[model samples]
Target: EPEVTQTPSHQVTQMGQEVILRCVPISNHLYFYWYRQILGQKVEFLVSFYNNEISEKSEIFDDQFSVERPDGSNFTLKIRSTKLEDSAMYFCASSEALETQYFGPGTRLLVL
Candidate 1:
């Protein structure tokens, strides 16, 4: 079965450093998105990318964050400066339509 894969399943960084998490969604899925879950908090939407541009973004996606599909297969999310509050599970997802999304296992990011 086709599925999303994320590299560096776990990441740890010092506060103020930068971090980049990668994902490879099912090849044929057309839409990509990034979402985050702080330890005890609800899942939050960060950004959505399509056609090589941002289609939508949430308030959480501030200047410190960015997303890209540097190649045809890999998608990435970069945090220019990590903060302790940024520690969370970051999930990448893809969907053929706007209604349903298939999510990656997620990369666990820990900031100190």
Candidate 2:
């Protein structure tokens, strides 16, 4: 079955650098999203993208974060400033429809 995939299962970064986490969503899906879960905390929605622009976003998706579909098969999330609080498992998800989303295993980001 086709599934969303993320690279660099775990990343250890310094407290003030840029990082780009990559993902390849399901080929046929129309909607894609980014969600993150701080270890032991609730999963929080970051942003949703469709038709090449942001469809929706939460407060957590501040100026530090950006998402893009750089090609037909890949999507990416770039963080401009890494903060200690930015440590979390970032999940990439895709859905044919809007409500139900299938998530990738997740890219664990740790800012030290």
lDDT for predicted candidate 2 compared with the true structure: 0.95
> What's the TM for model 1?
0.98
**Which digits, one per residue and each the tens of the lDDT, describe model 2 over residues 54-96?**
9999998999999999999999999999999999999999999
lDDT tens per residue, model 1, 1-112: 9999997799999999999999998999989999999998899999999899999999999999999899999999999999999999999999988879999999999999
Worst 10 residues of 1 by lDDT: 93-102
Each candidate's TM vs. the true structure?
0.98, 0.98
Runs in model 1 lying further than 4 Å from the true structure: none
